[model samples]
Target: MTAQQPAGGAAIPQRPAVDFGRRYITFETPRFAGRTPRRTMIVCAALALVILGAGLASLTLGAYEVSFGAVIRAIFDPASDPDARQVVFEWRLPRVLFAVLCGAALALSGGIFQSLTRNPLGSPDIIGFGVGAQFGVTLVMIVLELNTYLWKASGALVGGLLTALLVYALASKGGTSAFRLIIVGIGVSAGLGALTSWILITVSVEKAMMAATWGAGSIASLGFDQLAPAALVFAVILVLTLPLTRRLPVLEMGDDAAAALGIDAGRTRFAAVVLGVALIALVTAAAGPISFIALAAPQISQRLTRSNSPMGTLPVMLTGAALVVVSDAVAQLATVPVGVVTVSVGGIYLAWLLAAQYARRA
Candidate 1:
């Protein structure tokens, strides 16, 4: 460390730059970051404007006519118009909220899985989360469609959890290996995917068509009836996860360090896994299995914020919201569902991530 000079200049500590055996990774230590408070405020405000403006555009551009002013009025003062209110309140509002909710949940879920696995490639969908949910829904729709929405949600949750649980049991022993987890998750996902395909093929053509449609994760024709409950479920899980942020930091220190810090390492990890899986499941149940927001959001935010760790809450949520809203907008104009856009886009992202991981290994 260097001391300050009398000329109002302070010397700072210097050290030789080291590599992680591949490339150097460094970040602002919650201090000395290039962004000032004013810049951060401006950026956040701009992002909020973008989101709000997009919502207004979405509301007005639909089949029924609702002006920007009317939409705004309806948003603030609940009882605006009997007809326009139905348009904004019943239809557009839920879709917008669902888009935001799904985006936030998926990103948070991605951050958790990546942090837990210590891999940039870790995400629920990448590791068969969508397939798992598909399997769950397939089972429900094929054999038992009588379950209530809550029960159906439970089925989806169990399906995703069991799938991940199977992957972990198969791949992890003494220590969890990021590489192994991905491989196992891929194989398991593939098999589940095959099973899903088989179920679709073997059933009646109408049933198969129905399953195929929902699998794409469309937000089309979604109303408050479904959105309200789904949002509530996701919110509850999200709240439960807030305090566990510290545990995640500790977990990055490895099992031993986590235990040394008085965390029941196994228990903390299990809880994080359950929470992450539950969030993904909620989205999957409500909106069919969304493709890559979980995988893409955390990784994108990691690069954006230049954070050394997986994305924290605020950044990840914003990044996710931006992606889904933008994608949803694309979906509307393209004569396609949101799911197709995500899968296509997410497929490309997954390939790049794989290449990067391989390059780092090399």
Candidate 2:
């Protein structure tokens, strides 16, 4: 125990720094207990290894067989094997990169939203931003016929921002609560989903088919052309997000407590929402609303690390990358879009979450 002198000159007991091996590490301050940077880095390394293994498996086991040696050679020296070069560099690599980036973005976004609302169910997907992005893409791709990467991306960003605005407006009338935001979000999401469906229904058959494929959320056709822009945006937004997340744990103590701690809970919440929405919208534009990654990744990361926070941002991001990359690989085997796989898997997980919540309440 450590002692501290206050204005009253009384010493209060404080827990000393604790390190529980490589598995867990933390330190206690006068204010709160938090994970050490080293512990977070270890978790990140472990998750990165999983993503790397999964990515390598993805690169090797595809439509055309390529040896591990061939993959390495193709990556390092593309001219050695034309087939390997084309398959690896021109095709598989972009898909894998998009999956990893998109997954990380969604996972980070989910963590922010979950932390802000203090609810497990509060994710970008559940709160309607995903649907709104889709709606925006539908308008750009189907109606405007400006289906280029940049245009589609812009549409998704605008749509997601609008949806977030609406959700905030509805929930903030009497001051926002997690429950109110979720309820309003569900209604907004349903409405936006219907609008997307209607757009699909009204388009020409050719256009409808194209839109449907995009909606299914396949990263198969994307190249560096799409990946570069999305990556740039994600990188910039992530830089902005990291500073805000330091204040996120403060909100868990409630608004008044957070205020007493000299944190602006409302401004922090708004910044978080804006950053989170931007992250998800970029992914949706790059890969279509891939579904449930934002919902599942952070929660899964939290459980794995046994952390009190919904998800340590780094772990959540790496976990999301792993989840999406692995799921993309599985979806490839089935010759289906990754979204199909995620939705099916996420639906079951959501059901289990609901059941557990009910059982706990009962």
Candidate 3:
């Protein structure tokens, strides 16, 4: 599984010795470590093309029903048909791109969290990272009465990071056990969510309504400018993340083993939490904490591709894109909020997760 050995490769991260006996743990490094399975690569490529197709479809299809030709023309010759260009590129393209960006961000974040925690259920919404982001938004909307986009986003990032650290600190007493971490996270998230609810209830009715709608998530009128900064935030985090991927497989080898293998578990875990929280917080800030895209994306990606050390980051991104694009389409047609659609779907996935766990235990 070793790639061409570099001079300091082993020095950088001592090649971890991992052996899988008879039993299967999902988090085990693939037998084909350091090399992606050819089939999964092919599937990932197919999913990317499908995502591109969906993006084009989103641009072309709507109430006005622009032709593919017109959409193409509108994209290329903006001055020729200003109205159509506004509809196609300015309006629809941004939304489609938003879905892509949000999807990829959530999925990657979910994968990172799941990898770090070794818990499939470790997404922001369930584990309280999303709650933190929501708390941040609440502060801006309720206390400050200033929902300027960047301020709210800043709130989200701050809140999410703080909450994640608190959760980790509380859970680390007994050695950062995944089960304890998740349980503590659930408690923290519940408390924060209740606090958010209390604030909204106590506030003026108009503000409450606005908060509620935003909380439920809407892309109806979000322009490109509104979504751009969030994209930039995700991009910056992603650049920092690429170097960390190789470290993840080693960190999965338990804290003691990780230390033995020269992988700094504490630092690695911190990096994962920060990245995960930032990703979700930015999306929440931009899109109002939309539903289960973060939760569902990683799980679906893991199941679809069998080699799951958590998951290939790309598949999770693709799965997220598909989930949001599909969920957004449903939201548009059914008069449902994007967040609501995602929750309903996510609830189903959560149920399935519980059932599968029980079955495995039995």
User: Largest TM-score belongs to which candidate?
Assistant: 2
Clashes of each: 0, 0, 0
lDDT of each: 0.79, 0.87, 0.81
Candidate order by lDDT, decreasing, is 2, 3, 1
Q: Could you tell me the TM-score of candidate 1? A: 0.84
TM-score of each: 0.84, 0.88, 0.86
Query: Candidate 2, after superposition: displacement of residue 283 in Å?
Result: 0.7
TM-score of 2: 0.88
Off by over 4 Å in 2: 1-42, 76-79
- Per-residue lDDT for 155-255 in model 3, tens only? 99999998988888898895868889889999999999999999998999999999998988877668778877777778899898885677776787777
How big is the positional error of residue 57 in model 3, measured in Å on the Cα after superposition?
2.5
Instruction: Identify the superior model by lDDT, candidate 2 or candidate 3.
Output: 2
Better of 1 and 3 by TM-score: 3
